[model samples]
Target: MHIFEGFLPSPWWQVWFAISIPVIMYGIYQMNKLVSQRREIVPLLAVAGAFIFVLSSLKLPSVTGSSSHPTGTGMAAILFGPAVTSVLSVIVLLYQSLFLAHGGLTTLGANVFSMGIAGPFVAYALYKVASKAGMNFYLNVFLATAIADWVTYVVTSLQLALAFPFEGSVFASFKMFALVFATTQVPLAIMEGALTALIMKYVVQVKSDVLVGLNVLTSSAATKLREAME
Candidate 1:
Protein backbone atom coordinates (compact mmCIF):
# COMPACT_ATOMS: atom_id res chain seq x y z
CA MET A 1 0.00 0.00 0.00
CA HIS A 2 1.34 3.40 -1.04
CA ILE A 3 0.23 6.33 1.04
CA PHE A 4 0.18 9.54 -0.92
CA GLU A 5 2.11 12.66 0.02
CA GLY A 6 0.56 14.71 2.83
CA PHE A 7 -1.75 11.84 3.67
CA LEU A 8 -0.08 11.52 7.05
CA PRO A 9 -0.12 14.68 9.10
CA SER A 10 2.88 16.26 10.68
CA PRO A 11 4.60 14.63 13.67
CA TRP A 12 3.10 11.27 12.68
CA TRP A 13 5.28 11.08 9.64
CA GLN A 14 8.15 12.32 11.72
CA VAL A 15 7.42 9.64 14.27
CA TRP A 16 7.59 6.96 11.63
CA PHE A 17 10.75 8.46 10.24
CA ALA A 18 12.39 8.34 13.62
CA ILE A 19 11.34 4.75 14.12
CA SER A 20 12.49 3.56 10.69
CA ILE A 21 15.85 5.30 10.42
CA PRO A 22 17.79 3.01 12.74
CA VAL A 23 16.37 -0.10 11.14
CA ILE A 24 17.24 1.21 7.71
CA MET A 25 20.74 1.95 8.87
CA TYR A 26 21.12 -1.52 10.25
CA GLY A 27 19.86 -2.95 6.99
CA ILE A 28 22.46 -1.03 5.10
CA TYR A 29 25.16 -2.30 7.41
CA GLN A 30 23.99 -5.85 7.02
CA MET A 31 23.82 -5.50 3.25
CA ASN A 32 27.35 -4.18 3.11
CA LYS A 33 28.63 -7.02 5.24
CA LEU A 34 26.93 -9.61 3.07
CA VAL A 35 28.19 -7.99 -0.15
CA SER A 36 31.73 -7.94 1.18
CA GLN A 37 31.57 -11.66 1.84
CA ARG A 38 29.91 -12.47 -1.48
CA ARG A 39 30.43 -9.97 -4.27
CA GLU A 40 28.02 -11.95 -6.44
CA ILE A 41 25.16 -10.68 -4.24
CA VAL A 42 25.59 -7.19 -5.66
CA PRO A 43 23.88 -8.00 -8.93
CA LEU A 44 21.25 -10.03 -7.22
CA LEU A 45 20.56 -7.16 -4.86
CA ALA A 46 20.22 -4.78 -7.79
CA VAL A 47 17.87 -7.15 -9.53
CA ALA A 48 15.83 -7.51 -6.36
CA GLY A 49 15.52 -3.74 -6.07
CA ALA A 50 14.52 -3.48 -9.72
CA PHE A 51 11.93 -6.20 -9.34
CA ILE A 52 10.43 -4.44 -6.31
CA PHE A 53 10.46 -1.09 -8.07
CA VAL A 54 8.63 -2.41 -11.11
CA LEU A 55 6.00 -4.37 -9.24
CA SER A 56 5.34 -1.80 -6.54
CA SER A 57 5.17 1.06 -9.01
CA LEU A 58 2.11 -0.48 -10.63
CA LYS A 59 -0.44 1.00 -8.25
CA LEU A 60 -4.21 0.73 -8.20
CA PRO A 61 -6.41 3.23 -6.42
CA SER A 62 -7.69 1.96 -3.12
CA VAL A 63 -9.45 3.26 -0.06
CA THR A 64 -8.19 5.60 2.70
CA GLY A 65 -5.96 7.73 0.52
CA SER A 66 -3.69 4.77 -0.21
CA SER A 67 -3.13 2.59 -3.28
CA SER A 68 -2.55 -1.15 -3.63
CA HIS A 69 0.15 -3.05 -5.48
CA PRO A 70 2.15 -6.23 -5.30
CA THR A 71 4.98 -5.64 -2.84
CA GLY A 72 7.46 -8.10 -4.43
CA THR A 73 9.39 -7.92 -1.18
CA GLY A 74 8.85 -11.60 -0.49
CA MET A 75 11.31 -12.75 -3.14
CA ALA A 76 14.03 -10.54 -1.77
CA ALA A 77 13.26 -11.59 1.76
CA ILE A 78 13.35 -15.24 0.78
CA LEU A 79 16.65 -14.75 -1.00
CA PHE A 80 18.46 -12.31 1.26
CA GLY A 81 16.44 -12.22 4.44
CA PRO A 82 14.41 -9.33 5.83
CA ALA A 83 17.31 -7.11 6.88
CA VAL A 84 18.72 -6.81 3.36
CA THR A 85 15.24 -6.60 1.85
CA SER A 86 14.65 -3.48 3.93
CA VAL A 87 17.56 -1.76 2.27
CA LEU A 88 16.36 -2.70 -1.21
CA SER A 89 12.81 -1.60 -0.39
CA VAL A 90 13.91 1.81 0.85
CA ILE A 91 15.89 2.37 -2.36
CA VAL A 92 12.98 1.35 -4.55
CA LEU A 93 10.52 3.44 -2.52
CA LEU A 94 12.80 6.44 -2.71
CA TYR A 95 13.06 6.23 -6.49
CA GLN A 96 9.31 5.79 -6.89
CA SER A 97 8.62 8.76 -4.65
CA LEU A 98 11.09 11.02 -6.46
CA PHE A 99 10.35 10.15 -10.09
CA LEU A 100 7.07 8.25 -10.40
CA ALA A 101 5.26 10.18 -7.64
CA HIS A 102 3.73 6.85 -6.77
CA GLY A 103 4.40 7.49 -3.09
CA GLY A 104 5.45 10.57 -1.19
CA LEU A 105 8.57 11.54 0.70
CA THR A 106 6.77 12.55 3.87
CA THR A 107 5.03 9.21 4.00
CA LEU A 108 8.05 7.17 3.01
CA GLY A 109 8.77 6.00 6.54
CA ALA A 110 5.27 4.69 7.08
CA ASN A 111 5.27 3.01 3.68
CA VAL A 112 8.63 1.43 4.35
CA PHE A 113 7.53 0.12 7.73
CA SER A 114 4.40 -1.48 6.34
CA MET A 115 5.56 -2.69 2.93
CA GLY A 116 9.27 -3.11 3.46
CA ILE A 117 9.97 -4.23 7.00
CA ALA A 118 6.74 -5.77 8.18
CA GLY A 119 5.94 -7.78 5.06
CA PRO A 120 9.42 -9.13 4.49
CA PHE A 121 9.81 -10.24 8.09
CA VAL A 122 6.59 -12.19 7.85
CA ALA A 123 7.63 -13.74 4.57
CA TYR A 124 11.01 -14.74 5.97
CA ALA A 125 9.39 -16.33 8.99
CA LEU A 126 6.94 -18.23 6.85
CA TYR A 127 9.64 -19.39 4.48
CA LYS A 128 11.62 -20.78 7.40
CA VAL A 129 8.58 -22.53 8.78
CA ALA A 130 7.60 -23.98 5.43
CA SER A 131 11.11 -25.19 4.71
CA LYS A 132 11.40 -26.86 8.10
CA ALA A 133 8.03 -28.51 7.60
CA GLY A 134 9.21 -30.24 4.45
CA MET A 135 6.64 -28.49 2.30
CA ASN A 136 6.97 -28.40 -1.48
CA PHE A 137 9.34 -25.67 -2.50
CA TYR A 138 6.96 -23.92 -4.88
CA LEU A 139 4.11 -24.14 -2.42
CA ASN A 140 6.30 -22.68 0.31
CA VAL A 141 7.27 -19.79 -1.91
CA PHE A 142 3.64 -19.14 -2.86
CA LEU A 143 2.41 -19.09 0.69
CA ALA A 144 5.28 -16.93 1.87
CA THR A 145 4.89 -14.33 -0.86
CA ALA A 146 1.09 -14.24 -0.89
CA ILE A 147 0.78 -14.01 2.85
CA ALA A 148 3.51 -11.40 3.04
CA ASP A 149 1.67 -9.28 0.48
CA TRP A 150 -1.56 -9.52 2.46
CA VAL A 151 0.19 -8.74 5.75
CA THR A 152 1.69 -5.59 4.24
CA TYR A 153 -1.80 -4.27 3.56
CA VAL A 154 -2.91 -5.30 6.98
CA VAL A 155 -0.09 -3.33 8.60
CA THR A 156 -0.84 -0.39 6.32
CA SER A 157 -4.45 -0.48 7.39
CA LEU A 158 -3.32 -0.43 10.98
CA GLN A 159 -1.02 2.49 10.31
CA LEU A 160 -3.80 4.47 8.63
CA ALA A 161 -6.30 3.66 11.28
CA LEU A 162 -3.90 4.69 13.99
CA ALA A 163 -3.34 8.03 12.35
CA PHE A 164 -7.04 8.70 11.72
CA PRO A 165 -9.29 6.50 13.68
CA PHE A 166 -12.97 5.98 12.91
CA GLU A 167 -15.59 6.74 15.56
CA GLY A 168 -12.77 7.67 17.89
CA SER A 169 -11.86 4.01 18.16
CA VAL A 170 -8.64 2.78 16.64
CA PHE A 171 -9.81 -0.81 16.41
CA ALA A 172 -12.98 0.23 14.58
CA SER A 173 -10.94 2.23 12.14
CA PHE A 174 -8.57 -0.70 11.69
CA LYS A 175 -11.42 -3.04 10.78
CA MET A 176 -12.90 -0.55 8.35
CA PHE A 177 -9.63 0.05 6.56
CA ALA A 178 -8.87 -3.67 6.53
CA LEU A 179 -12.24 -4.47 4.93
CA VAL A 180 -11.77 -1.80 2.30
CA PHE A 181 -8.29 -3.08 1.48
CA ALA A 182 -9.32 -6.74 1.39
CA THR A 183 -11.53 -6.12 -1.64
CA THR A 184 -8.56 -5.52 -3.95
CA GLN A 185 -5.60 -6.69 -1.90
CA VAL A 186 -6.53 -10.36 -1.65
CA PRO A 187 -6.55 -11.05 -5.39
CA LEU A 188 -3.47 -8.92 -5.89
CA ALA A 189 -1.60 -10.91 -3.25
CA ILE A 190 -2.60 -14.21 -4.85
CA MET A 191 -1.39 -13.02 -8.24
CA GLU A 192 1.88 -11.85 -6.70
CA GLY A 193 2.31 -15.25 -5.09
CA ALA A 194 1.76 -17.09 -8.36
CA LEU A 195 4.21 -14.90 -10.22
CA THR A 196 6.82 -15.25 -7.48
CA ALA A 197 6.39 -19.01 -7.45
CA LEU A 198 7.01 -19.22 -11.18
CA ILE A 199 10.11 -17.07 -10.89
CA MET A 200 11.45 -19.17 -8.03
CA LYS A 201 10.90 -22.36 -10.05
CA TYR A 202 12.78 -20.92 -13.01
CA VAL A 203 15.63 -19.84 -10.75
CA VAL A 204 15.71 -23.30 -9.21
CA GLN A 205 16.04 -24.90 -12.60
CA VAL A 206 18.69 -22.62 -14.10
CA LYS A 207 20.49 -21.11 -11.11
CA SER A 208 19.85 -23.35 -8.17
CA ASP A 209 23.40 -22.69 -7.07
CA VAL A 210 22.42 -19.12 -6.32
CA LEU A 211 19.81 -20.41 -3.93
CA VAL A 212 22.33 -22.71 -2.35
CA GLY A 213 24.88 -19.94 -2.05
CA LEU A 214 22.32 -17.80 -0.23
CA ASN A 215 21.43 -20.73 1.98
CA VAL A 216 17.86 -20.37 0.79
CA LEU A 217 17.96 -24.08 -0.06
CA THR A 218 20.14 -26.67 1.61
CA SER A 219 22.60 -28.72 -0.43
CA SER A 220 20.39 -31.76 -0.15
CA ALA A 221 17.40 -29.74 -1.24
CA ALA A 222 19.30 -28.41 -4.24
CA THR A 223 20.29 -31.90 -5.25
CA LYS A 224 16.69 -33.04 -4.98
CA LEU A 225 15.58 -30.08 -7.11
CA ARG A 226 18.12 -30.92 -9.87
CA GLU A 227 17.01 -34.52 -9.82
CA ALA A 228 13.42 -33.43 -10.25
CA MET A 229 14.40 -31.16 -13.13
CA GLU A 230 16.19 -34.03 -14.88
Candidate 2:
Protein backbone atom coordinates (compact mmCIF):
# COMPACT_ATOMS: atom_id res chain seq x y z
CA MET A 1 0.00 0.00 0.00
CA HIS A 2 1.40 3.34 -0.98
CA ILE A 3 1.11 5.69 1.97
CA PHE A 4 0.59 8.97 0.15
CA GLU A 5 0.74 12.46 1.59
CA GLY A 6 -1.58 13.21 4.51
CA PHE A 7 -2.16 9.51 5.11
CA LEU A 8 -0.21 9.46 8.36
CA PRO A 9 -0.45 11.51 11.51
CA SER A 10 1.55 14.62 10.82
CA PRO A 11 3.46 14.59 14.12
CA TRP A 12 4.43 10.92 14.03
CA TRP A 13 5.30 11.14 10.36
CA GLN A 14 7.55 14.11 11.00
CA VAL A 15 9.39 12.15 13.67
CA TRP A 16 9.71 9.14 11.37
CA PHE A 17 10.99 11.31 8.55
CA ALA A 18 13.59 12.83 10.88
CA ILE A 19 14.69 9.40 12.08
CA SER A 20 14.71 8.09 8.51
CA ILE A 21 17.12 10.77 7.25
CA PRO A 22 20.19 9.36 9.00
CA VAL A 23 19.18 5.85 8.15
CA ILE A 24 18.95 6.75 4.46
CA MET A 25 22.27 8.55 4.72
CA TYR A 26 23.90 5.50 6.24
CA GLY A 27 22.52 3.36 3.42
CA ILE A 28 23.81 5.86 0.90
CA TYR A 29 27.25 5.77 2.50
CA GLN A 30 27.25 1.99 2.36
CA MET A 31 26.33 2.10 -1.32
CA ASN A 32 29.18 4.49 -1.98
CA LYS A 33 31.65 2.11 -0.36
CA LEU A 34 30.34 -0.81 -2.38
CA VAL A 35 30.39 1.22 -5.58
CA SER A 36 33.98 2.29 -5.04
CA GLN A 37 35.06 -1.31 -4.78
CA ARG A 38 33.34 -2.27 -8.02
CA ARG A 39 34.07 0.54 -10.38
CA GLU A 40 33.82 -1.64 -13.48
CA ILE A 41 30.47 -3.03 -12.38
CA VAL A 42 28.91 0.40 -12.15
CA PRO A 43 27.92 0.37 -15.81
CA LEU A 44 26.32 -3.01 -15.36
CA LEU A 45 24.45 -1.62 -12.39
CA ALA A 46 23.04 1.15 -14.55
CA VAL A 47 21.90 -1.43 -17.05
CA ALA A 48 20.32 -3.47 -14.32
CA GLY A 49 18.65 -0.39 -12.87
CA ALA A 50 17.15 0.46 -16.25
CA PHE A 51 15.94 -3.10 -16.63
CA ILE A 52 14.34 -2.89 -13.19
CA PHE A 53 12.75 0.42 -13.95
CA VAL A 54 11.11 -0.97 -17.06
CA LEU A 55 10.07 -4.22 -15.44
CA SER A 56 8.57 -2.32 -12.51
CA SER A 57 6.48 -0.29 -14.89
CA LEU A 58 4.37 -3.33 -15.68
CA LYS A 59 1.57 -4.12 -13.26
CA LEU A 60 -0.16 -7.44 -12.69
CA PRO A 61 -3.79 -7.64 -11.62
CA SER A 62 -4.46 -8.70 -8.07
CA VAL A 63 -7.35 -10.62 -6.54
CA THR A 64 -8.31 -7.46 -4.67
CA GLY A 65 -8.86 -5.77 -8.02
CA SER A 66 -5.77 -3.68 -7.44
CA SER A 67 -2.69 -4.09 -9.54
CA SER A 68 0.83 -4.27 -8.08
CA HIS A 69 4.24 -4.12 -9.63
CA PRO A 70 7.32 -5.99 -8.51
CA THR A 71 9.97 -4.05 -6.68
CA GLY A 72 13.30 -5.11 -8.18
CA THR A 73 15.36 -4.26 -5.14
CA GLY A 74 15.87 -7.93 -4.27
CA MET A 75 17.31 -8.63 -7.68
CA ALA A 76 19.67 -5.66 -7.40
CA ALA A 77 20.67 -6.73 -3.91
CA ILE A 78 21.39 -10.22 -5.15
CA LEU A 79 23.72 -8.85 -7.80
CA PHE A 80 25.23 -5.76 -6.19
CA GLY A 81 24.54 -6.47 -2.54
CA PRO A 82 21.87 -4.85 -0.36
CA ALA A 83 23.86 -1.69 0.26
CA VAL A 84 23.74 -0.76 -3.40
CA THR A 85 20.16 -1.94 -3.67
CA SER A 86 19.19 0.44 -0.86
CA VAL A 87 20.51 3.43 -2.75
CA LEU A 88 19.18 2.16 -6.06
CA SER A 89 15.82 1.65 -4.48
CA VAL A 90 15.70 5.24 -3.26
CA ILE A 91 16.59 6.45 -6.72
CA VAL A 92 14.03 4.21 -8.34
CA LEU A 93 11.40 5.33 -5.85
CA LEU A 94 12.24 8.95 -6.50
CA TYR A 95 11.91 8.49 -10.23
CA GLN A 96 8.62 6.67 -9.82
CA SER A 97 7.31 9.43 -7.59
CA LEU A 98 8.19 12.13 -10.06
CA PHE A 99 7.19 10.35 -13.23
CA LEU A 100 4.54 7.82 -12.38
CA ALA A 101 3.41 9.30 -9.10
CA HIS A 102 3.09 5.76 -7.88
CA GLY A 103 4.21 6.78 -4.43
CA GLY A 104 4.32 10.30 -3.02
CA LEU A 105 7.36 12.41 -2.22
CA THR A 106 6.40 12.88 1.40
CA THR A 107 6.18 9.13 1.95
CA LEU A 108 9.21 8.30 -0.18
CA GLY A 109 11.44 7.76 2.82
CA ALA A 110 9.04 5.28 4.33
CA ASN A 111 8.70 3.50 1.02
CA VAL A 112 12.47 3.31 0.73
CA PHE A 113 12.74 1.79 4.18
CA SER A 114 10.12 -0.81 3.45
CA MET A 115 10.63 -1.85 -0.17
CA GLY A 116 14.29 -0.90 -0.52
CA ILE A 117 15.78 -1.61 2.91
CA ALA A 118 13.65 -4.48 4.15
CA GLY A 119 13.18 -6.24 0.81
CA PRO A 120 16.85 -6.47 -0.11
CA PHE A 121 18.08 -7.34 3.38
CA VAL A 122 15.52 -10.07 3.82
CA ALA A 123 16.23 -11.48 0.37
CA TYR A 124 19.96 -11.48 0.95
CA ALA A 125 19.59 -13.12 4.34
CA LEU A 126 17.31 -15.79 2.98
CA TYR A 127 19.59 -16.48 0.04
CA LYS A 128 22.52 -16.86 2.39
CA VAL A 129 20.60 -19.22 4.62
CA ALA A 130 19.35 -21.30 1.73
CA SER A 131 22.83 -21.53 0.24
CA LYS A 132 24.21 -22.67 3.57
CA ALA A 133 21.48 -25.28 3.79
CA GLY A 134 22.46 -26.58 0.35
CA MET A 135 19.11 -25.78 -1.16
CA ASN A 136 18.68 -26.03 -4.92
CA PHE A 137 19.22 -22.86 -6.93
CA TYR A 138 15.62 -22.41 -8.01
CA LEU A 139 14.25 -23.08 -4.55
CA ASN A 140 16.72 -20.65 -3.06
CA VAL A 141 15.60 -18.05 -5.55
CA PHE A 142 11.93 -18.72 -4.92
CA LEU A 143 12.07 -18.66 -1.13
CA ALA A 144 14.35 -15.66 -0.89
CA THR A 145 12.16 -13.49 -3.10
CA ALA A 146 8.96 -14.65 -1.45
CA ILE A 147 10.21 -14.00 2.06
CA ALA A 148 11.68 -10.66 1.07
CA ASP A 149 8.46 -9.46 -0.55
CA TRP A 150 6.42 -10.53 2.44
CA VAL A 151 8.84 -8.80 4.75
CA THR A 152 8.48 -5.62 2.70
CA TYR A 153 4.72 -5.69 3.13
CA VAL A 154 4.95 -6.57 6.80
CA VAL A 155 7.34 -3.72 7.42
CA THR A 156 5.07 -1.37 5.48
CA SER A 157 2.05 -2.44 7.48
CA LEU A 158 3.88 -1.76 10.70
CA GLN A 159 4.92 1.63 9.43
CA LEU A 160 1.35 2.48 8.53
CA ALA A 161 0.06 1.31 11.88
CA LEU A 162 2.71 3.23 13.72
CA ALA A 163 2.08 6.35 11.67
CA PHE A 164 -1.56 6.44 12.59
CA PRO A 165 -3.63 5.20 15.52
CA PHE A 166 -5.67 2.15 14.69
CA GLU A 167 -8.90 1.32 16.41
CA GLY A 168 -7.86 -2.24 17.18
CA SER A 169 -4.78 -4.26 18.03
CA VAL A 170 -1.72 -3.65 15.92
CA PHE A 171 -1.49 -7.35 15.23
CA ALA A 172 -5.03 -7.26 14.00
CA SER A 173 -4.23 -4.50 11.58
CA PHE A 174 -1.25 -6.41 10.29
CA LYS A 175 -3.35 -9.52 9.89
CA MET A 176 -6.00 -7.64 7.99
CA PHE A 177 -3.43 -6.15 5.73
CA ALA A 178 -1.76 -9.49 5.18
CA LEU A 179 -5.07 -11.04 4.26
CA VAL A 180 -5.87 -8.35 1.75
CA PHE A 181 -2.45 -7.95 0.21
CA ALA A 182 -0.95 -11.38 0.68
CA THR A 183 -2.70 -12.82 -2.37
CA THR A 184 -0.94 -10.34 -4.62
CA GLN A 185 2.25 -9.93 -2.60
CA VAL A 186 2.90 -13.64 -2.19
CA PRO A 187 2.67 -14.32 -5.89
CA LEU A 188 4.66 -11.20 -6.59
CA ALA A 189 7.39 -12.60 -4.35
CA ILE A 190 7.51 -15.78 -6.37
CA MET A 191 7.72 -13.75 -9.55
CA GLU A 192 10.44 -11.59 -8.06
CA GLY A 193 12.45 -14.66 -7.14
CA ALA A 194 12.14 -16.23 -10.57
CA LEU A 195 12.87 -12.99 -12.39
CA THR A 196 15.81 -12.25 -10.14
CA ALA A 197 17.23 -15.70 -10.74
CA LEU A 198 16.81 -15.37 -14.49
CA ILE A 199 18.44 -11.96 -14.64
CA MET A 200 21.24 -12.98 -12.32
CA LYS A 201 21.86 -16.02 -14.45
CA TYR A 202 22.23 -13.75 -17.47
CA VAL A 203 24.54 -11.39 -15.58
CA VAL A 204 26.68 -14.24 -14.33
CA GLN A 205 26.80 -15.70 -17.81
CA VAL A 206 27.89 -12.57 -19.62
CA LYS A 207 30.30 -11.31 -16.96
CA SER A 208 31.21 -14.03 -14.55
CA ASP A 209 34.65 -12.52 -14.31
CA VAL A 210 33.20 -9.27 -13.06
CA LEU A 211 31.01 -11.03 -10.52
CA VAL A 212 33.92 -13.16 -9.35
CA GLY A 213 36.04 -10.08 -8.83
CA LEU A 214 33.18 -8.75 -6.72
CA ASN A 215 32.89 -12.13 -4.98
CA VAL A 216 29.32 -12.51 -6.19
CA LEU A 217 29.76 -15.34 -8.70
CA THR A 218 31.85 -18.35 -7.89
CA SER A 219 34.19 -19.58 -10.63
CA SER A 220 32.18 -22.72 -11.34
CA ALA A 221 28.82 -21.00 -11.43
CA ALA A 222 30.24 -18.29 -13.60
CA THR A 223 31.68 -20.79 -16.03
CA LYS A 224 28.41 -22.65 -16.23
CA LEU A 225 26.45 -19.50 -16.84
CA ARG A 226 28.93 -18.37 -19.44
CA GLU A 227 28.60 -21.63 -21.32
CA ALA A 228 24.84 -21.48 -21.13
CA MET A 229 24.80 -17.94 -22.41
CA GLU A 230 27.11 -18.84 -25.26
Q: Which candidate tops TM-score?
A: 1
* Weakest lDDT window of 10 consecutive positions for candidate 1: 59-68
Q: Using lDDT as the measure, which candidate wins? A: 1
Whole-model alpha-carbon lDDT for candidate 1: 0.88
Off by over 4 Å in 1: 57-68
lDDT of 2 by residue, 1-230 (tens): 45676666667666666766776788778766767986765787678778778878877544456577777777667666777777777778888888887887778778888888888888888877777776765567767776788888888888876754358677777767667767777777766667767666666656667667666656776676577557
For each candidate in the order shown, give its overall lDDT on alpha carbons.
0.88, 0.73
| TM-score quality measure for candidate 1 | 0.90
- Give residue 45's lDDT in candidate 2 (0 to 100): 69
User: What lDDT score is found at residue 156 in candidate 2?
Assistant: 80
Superposition-based RMSD of candidate 1 using all C-alpha atoms, in angstroms: 3.2
What residue pairs clash in candidate 2, if any at all? none
Q: All candidates' TM-scores?
A: 0.90, 0.83
